[model samples]
Target: MAETILVTGATGTVGSELVRALINRGVNTRAAVHSIIKGDRLRHFNPEVQLVEVDYHRPASLPLAFTGVDRVFLLTPFSDQQLIINQQLVDAAKAAGVQQVVRLSAAGADMEPGIQLGRWHRQMEQYLEQSGLSHVILRPTSFMQNFVNYQGQSIREQGAIYLPLGEGRMSYIDAFDIAEVAAAILTDDVAKHHGQAYTLTGPQAVNHTEIAGIIGQATGRPVQYVDVPETAARQAMQGAPQWMVDSMMELNALGKAGHLAGTTPAVEQLTGRPPRSFQEFAQEHRHELMPA
Candidate 1:
């Protein structure tokens, strides 16, 4: 019998790509999405991919999704409630007798207890370890997809990338590569990766100025990276909850301190290939980054 894998956050950036990768490998895949309507994006894989509704807050809804699932790919959206939500899923997975769990976490998750996101992920990591289910914790560096998700409008309208990162260099990995790594671990022999924590990073580290140059070359436009003071960034993000603003500022402070810089071999070690460079990512998504 083939292993049946359940993927939570199945319509998201890494989850969506992981679903495709699993399907391509001819694995038994179930996509646990929040809503069947929004999951239509994954219809292309229908018949081959099973779609199930999952509500993290409501623990009662998770067991049915985990039925007969051999392993799980867990991802909870970033928020104040992430710890509670993921704990709910972990409890559900344990109850379902799932064999393994691969969690998508962030860099510094194990090291920086003071960072809000890192703290939350570490808490979940600890819980999963104690849950008695075999687990793989993937702590990937900054995502290259931030261009599209967070800074696309600024780049398109002003030809600039604005952040409070100062001159901090980050080895940002592509979301697709993170998915690839997850797929590899999920489909391969589970014993090799169980109880392991891997930090994923791109092949090279680059600062915002270098990224701006790469974007300019890719889109054939003059793009600039403007470093704003944390205070100015906080003012610009006015009206967002104070916690969110503080979290963003803390992350920037970490970046500016060179804490987020450096490459890791975990991606290559796991996938047997080097992670994608930011230049390649920018080039591939140039049309999207280019002014509309």
Candidate 2:
């Protein structure tokens, strides 16, 4: 019998793509979503999928979501409550007799005295390590999708990308590559990847200005990268929680320091293909980045 894999955060960016990847591999996939309504879209995409609403607020939902599941793909939302939420999921997975867990962590998660984002993810990694469950941690750098999710509006209206990154570059990975890596690990031998951590990244590093040029060349529009002051970036996020605002500023500081720069071979090692380049990402998302 084939193993049944449960994916938490199933409607999220990487989780949604993971569901598709798993389905493409003909794996038995159970998607644990917070909103059954949103999960209906997955059903439309593939009727063979099993959807279970897992409310972190409700303890009962966790067990039901893990029931009959052999392994789990864990991707938690970014927030102040991330550590606590991850603990809950880890405990639930432990009690459910799940064999392995593939955790979607952030790049630099293992850094000592790391920034807020890295510290939060590292804490979860430590917890998962202590849980005695087989696990694989994927620490992917800045996501290429952030261009569309966070800055697409600006690009659409003004043909510009704004950030406090300065000249710092990062090897931004496509969430599709992350999903494919996770699917490969989840379906392959657990003993091979057990307790392993992979730093997933794109084929190369590029700064915001270079990114702008790539998008412009791909879409046939002049897009410029505007390096705003850190204070201005903070002000732009005024509506967000104080913790989120502060953490984002910390990340911006890291980017400005060139700490997030570097390429890794983990994606290719696991997926058996080189990760997507920023140019490819820009071209594929041109519709979203182009002026409306």
Candidate 3:
């Protein structure tokens, strides 16, 4: 019997890329998405990807999504709904006779509620362990693509970046690399990785000022870093919805305490290559980092 793997958050930045890698490998892929529109968009890679709409708030819809799937790629949306969503998936996965789950979790997920997202992911990781399912937790640090976020404003209008991070070093991993690792775990019988947790990070820990200098060199503009109070930074994002506002603030607080500096050999161990550097990420998406 051919085993099937259902990937949640298939429309998201990481899941979307994993879906492609699975298709290229010819894995029996199941895309569990929040919207049919998103699933349909992903069908471009291969019509073999079975698309199913799954809202974890409604767990009844999940058993059907999990039917005939041997493994699952569980990615809880990083929002208010993460805990309930993870709980629902765990319950449904147990009920559906699923074999394994590769959870997309946050870095520094210790038992003591670490931070906002970190806390919830730790809770979910515990729940999955208690559920007795074969599981592998992939905890990745900050994402390099987030720098693309500041590109528009910094390159286009701001001509500089204002963040609370100051010179705090961070090991920002690439989303695509994270997704590839997820796909590898799902398709392999490498039992060594099961019941284990992996932490992924970029090749180097660099500061925001260094990032500014890198962008300045890449874009032919003098980009400077302006550090502000965390309160002021949160206030600057007042237009962001409550969940995002709270999440970013909690993350910055974690950064100030020196959490994001953690690095690992897990990326190369799994993918057989060193994780992408900030410079490589910046160069590949320079257009996104530069103002139009």
lDDT of each: 0.90, 0.92, 0.84
For candidate 3, the per-residue lDDT at 36 reads: 90
Q: Which candidate number would show the highest TM-score if scored against the true structure?
A: 2
lDDT of 1 by residue, 19-91 (tens): 9889988999999998998987886965668999987677789889999999999999877888889889999
**Backbone clashes in each candidate structure, one number apiece?**
0, 0, 0
Ten contiguous residues minimizing lDDT sum, candidate 1 = 39-48
Q: Candidate 3: how many backbone clashes?
A: 0
Per-residue accuracy of model 3 over 48-140 as CA lDDT, tens digit each: 789999977777898899999899999988778778889999888988988899999988887365676777788899999899888999999
Relative to the true structure, candidate 3 reaches a TM of: 0.92
In model 3, which regions exceed 4 Å deviation? 111-113, 149-151, 239-244
In model 3, residue pairs whose N, Cα or C atoms come closer than 3 Å (at least 3 residues apart or on different chains), thus clashing, are none
Which has the better TM-score: candidate 2, or candidate 3? 2
**True-structure Cα RMSD, model 3:** 2.0
| Candidate RMSDs in order | 1.2, 0.9, 2.0
Candidates 1 and 3, the one with greater TM-score: 1
